[model samples]
Target chain A: MRIADAGDPLMGQLVARYGAEEALAQVREGRLGPGFVAEIAARRGKPIDCERRLAAWRARLPYVDAEADLARGEELGARLVVPGDVEWPTQLDDLHHERPLGLWLHGSADLRFACLRSVSIVGSRAATPYGVHVAAELAAGLSEAGWTIVSGGAYGIDAAAHRGALAGVAETIAVLACGTDVAYPAGNHGLFEGMRARGLLVSECPPGVRPTRIRFLVRNRLIAALTRGTVVVEAAIRSGALSTAGHAVKLSRHVAAVPGPVTSGNSIGCHRLIRRAEAVCVTTTHEVIELMAAIGDDLSPEPRAPVLPRDRLDAESRSILEAVPSRSGAGPATIAVSAGVDLMTTLSHLGVLAAAGYVERTDHGWRLRRST
Target chain B: MRIADAGDPLMGQLVARYGAEEALAQVREGRLGPGFVAEIAARRGKPIDCERRLAAWRARLPYVDAEADLARGEELGARLVVPGDVEWPTQLDDLHHERPLGLWLHGSADLRFACLRSVSIVGSRAATPYGVHVAAELAAGLSEAGWTIVSGGAYGIDAAAHRGALAGVAETIAVLACGTDVAYPAGNHGLFEGMRARGLLVSECPPGVRPTRIRFLVRNRLIAALTRGTVVVEAAIRSGALSTAGHAVKLSRHVAAVPGPVTSGNSIGCHRLIRRAEAVCVTTTHEVIELMAAIGDDLSPEPRAPVLPRDRLDAESRSILEAVPSRSGAGPATIAVSAGVDLMTTLSHLGVLAAAGYVERTDHGWRLRRST
Candidate 1:
């Protein structure tokens, strides 16, 4: 592992020292970090607050110790994932200039693989029981179908979603506003540990930072960007969940909403989105998957997930893909047995792979595609 | 009123004798009625069944007496309104050839005036309390806003809507499947009387005819065509209420549906409509009025019925209109006192008059528009 002084000066170390906004300013100016502060000063149309921001960062510099924080993260069993790292989720690149400098991840699951075919399920912290029920069911169904569920790890609907994915014994990622190791809500500490054992707990902040109200809002974009589509379970008219849905729309990701009782204040935002034609109304988890699928053919409303492409496939999916023969092909059972994967997973993968063009369904079973 | 013999012989008497299909075939062949039988026989490439239908009609003609039916309707205290009558609702013209030959009306309210700025509220007869609540609330709100509410006077949701309008002291038309004189759902005989007392009970069939199951389905089109918009409060996937919404869509009228608990099977049709982007999802009465009001201009879901012109105004609205001055406007209280109407009704009529372009809102109160 590269220490602050040992490796590229333009890494998470600079971000931890200068703060993400200042670090982001440097990146926007095509200057890597503080080393190129003079170059940013020379650039035309640079933010007028640049000097003030730079001075503030300079003042805070002595107190910032990136190497020590990195050590702390390492001690806490967390890994730093910079832009070029294998675990970095590429969908965050949709944010471009606003993308985080790096992520601090906790848990064993590969973040990139987990998000390969993922959908975000999110809603209000003050969710109604109906909201909680729908969120959990949708997450569970999507997870069981081999698609990962992503959510901000908060109380209410988010907590329900995480439990649902785990209940299905499927992959999940809990993106947090606070440090992944810090239990901000306290009540969800057990859930945090559960997610760490199964899925991943992700955060943009360094180790030991606490969550603020603003941080939760700041964290919503990541949840939206990490997934192919987002299903808003339920939200009040001005719920923060709407901001996540807005982000997904700006990113050109399909946004779906579950309808609820109109009388319930929890459903107002969903109905508003639907009435405005801003989001498609979805009732079942199957419908959410249909919308999340890469293929847009078969315009009918019947729930059918499009196949996951090879590049979007998870590690196990790729391994399973290789197990299928090009000529005679293989029965799903044969493929599952050979790949050392479960029958449900093998079938799920084959359905998507056949849809994605990597394989074809043969009279016997499944075979590698002639084109690919 | 002219007996059917003195009027267009091509009207209901022939249809009643030979059936609508056979009579329509004769009409399509350029035959007016049995009087034009020779002309139909003379036509080349005429339908082979024409003569048989014509003979059947002629044989039944001896049993058909238009004068007696007219007398029967009159004796029932119902007025027979054929096409071209001042009391006829012209929006029904949207049906073209499928338009009813005449309407039997039982009420003191003018039919044309009652439907001028009307909305049809309909839903499943097997409505849940939630459906009934929403339908009634929506109907009452529309009624209080000076818009007439129209509905089929059946049990459940239909009964709720009619009663809701009456409770609001607003005009409502009950488009019946059977003769206006006969209440088909005997349970709602009291509701039918209430409608006749406060609004109108309308039927296309002559007096003494019974309601067939097919007749209810056939009558749904009239409800859709008679109003500026149709609000489907609640419906199952196969609810006949959807048929009315479908007819509204076909006729280019605004169609809206109320959102309900997604778990309820009763809301399936409404959810389907909203999900398919076929109907606007409305919750509040304010939203419904905003949809129905023309003054919203482009903000409305559609530009539908302008307010009925002053000449088409009901006797009370006309009196209220006269009470407002051309130069100096008057408050609703003053206008109501002068017009011998209640303040609430006066205010409601003024809102419509302002929307209709006959009146303008001034700093003083309400005034006749310079154009009108």
Candidate 2:
């Protein structure tokens, strides 16, 4: 519990290379371990102040209580999922040294299974009505397609996404920066409770930890890492949602952004991402699914013009149809002459065109079908 | 005037390969020797319909009068621009066999020069207000940046683009399906007059020719070929604007599409174009310029987060700044240990940080600068 620091890459590396227990024991005893020190220096890209780091760690030792932290989590009905736990999402290992030491999960849904086919939808906390509408619609559609929707637990776009997903068939997950038991926003307390009942509330922080500004930035990496791809519904040019997209880019996951009116300042970040080729411009839920699903498993069909009855005719038939009188009618001989085709060719095509509803037999001869 | 067909690929190729005079004599005499016949077959991708095609041309000969047509054009203040004319846009030659044999221009602006840095803005006649607003904004910006705007003189997006460009310093051209001297829509007569006074009106049709549905389809190619790129402002699923984009793509001209609310039916074709990778997603006029201008010459600067005072600090200085109290204050010795840096290093960085508006010295120690 004392060694879980997502922002401290050097500590994460030490815990990853050496066992968490050994790394903690070394920190506790203030021993001069050459191997651990060298590893830390390499990760830091410079020589580290081992003595100072150890001193800092020792200072926090008095407050560390692994058993008590677990008990506190149990009291809140949340469970701890370590690196090798069955419910642990292995995709997060893609973060390597930056991965959380463990995750605190509070909900009925299994974290690993729920995240197997998940996509993150994140955007501005002060989104416009257009942004909120797009986020919710996208989430609902994705959720109904049997893919879980993941998001932050804040208001605006995140809250809309969570609520939309809840309305669908699949479960939703919100990865918060605060502890699973603590709803930092307080305004989202009901949302958090609803998630706990039906979906999942996940965090790396221990039971009683409160979120800070830095924690939110660090938490963005987890949101990017746990999903197959991340979709930015709406964001300003400097929004924190962009940081999550940056993480997705670094992780080599697909990144997609929903476009809105250029007049909307909230859509600037999305348009910029698209302009820079950092993200794909996604308009509909089917397009999002196409990005998240396997190559050929969920391909979006090409958009096409609605087919007209005359569109089914061959080139010669079309020329003949055009020659047919719109007002009255024309005989095959006159139509053939006007169409520059032989009478026999015109006669045969007229029969086919008539059968296809492009032409009809009138008392005089042949004419274009009224609707066609 | 007899040889001014835009739809006849074989005729265009013949006029291009052999000079117009020679091609005309061959067609007029009904003696298209083997060479001309083979050329026509090659362009048509099949055996030539020599007898029938010749019959059709021979039939129209009685109605053509080259001298009288020129006199009529002179009366209307319209000039004919053939392939070798100095005012002709050679970019149209990229269409090869599909290129127009000649263009009729009726305006003060130079056809070739105005088209030198032009972009076509086209979309649905049924565009929503959002599309019109974006189109005008983009056009005005590009025009102010010294780009000529080209579009059909239609009711919606096209009119907006032309009007916006007219509002800027650069000239705007409208490529019409009908005669340059004739306003097909009638309602756009005033717009055509304004264009003739400041910009230009161009067409392949003769002085008094009227437009048909097929002529509009054929005219889209000219719009695409005349510019550095084409931007689709708004379009329904089967809109004519998409055909213009298609022509732009085939001509290797840059193609961009402005995005609108996904709920808008008029934006469906534009989103489809983006989704299909047929068009780049463009929001601002600067992004459109980035696509049209040579690489690195008119590049749009990458969007960035607003700079903060502490953002300039090096890692050590940032740590020192973080250690400084926000609400209260802390002494150098206390901050050094808290930040895991030596007292001297902390003191040196605190001085640099204070000078940069990040921190301020106080009786107790140092504190973060207000608003910094």
TM-score of chain B of each: 0.69, 0.85
Candidate 1 displacement at residue B288 in angstroms? 1.8
lDDT of 2 by residue, A1-372 (tens): 454345576667767777888888888887746787886678669998777666755655666789999999999999999999999999988998888888899999999999999999999999999989989999999989998988999889999999889888888999988888786789989888988988999998889777756678899999999999999999998788999999999999999999888888899999888877899989889999999998988987766689976567676676677678787988887777656566677889989888877889989989988887
Q: Which candidate has the highest lDDT of all?
A: 2
Per-residue alpha-carbon lDDT of candidate 1 for residues B1-372, written as tens digits (9 for 90 to 100): 111211123344456457656765664564546544444345434533444333333433434567888899888899988778999899987876467877889987899998988999999999999889888888887788788888898887888999889888679999888888786889988888888888999887678766654567778888999999999988887777998999999989889998887678888888888877788889877778777768754243431224435548786677677767889878877666555455666789889878888888889988989997
| Local accuracy of candidate 2 as per-residue lDDT tens digits, B1-372 | 454346577667667777778878887887765677876778668997776666655555666788988999999999998888899899988998888888899989999999999999999998899988999999999999999999999999999999899888899999998888776789988889989998999988888877756678899999999999999999999889999999999999999999888878899998888877899988888889989998888987666678875566676676667668887889897777656566667788888888777899888779988877
Please state the error at residue A199 of candidate 1 in Å.
1.3
Task: Note the Cα lDDT for every prediction shown.
Answer: 0.76, 0.85
Candidate 2 collision pairs: none
- Model 2: residues >4 Å from true position, as ranges? A42-45, A314-372, B1-4, B42-45, B313-372
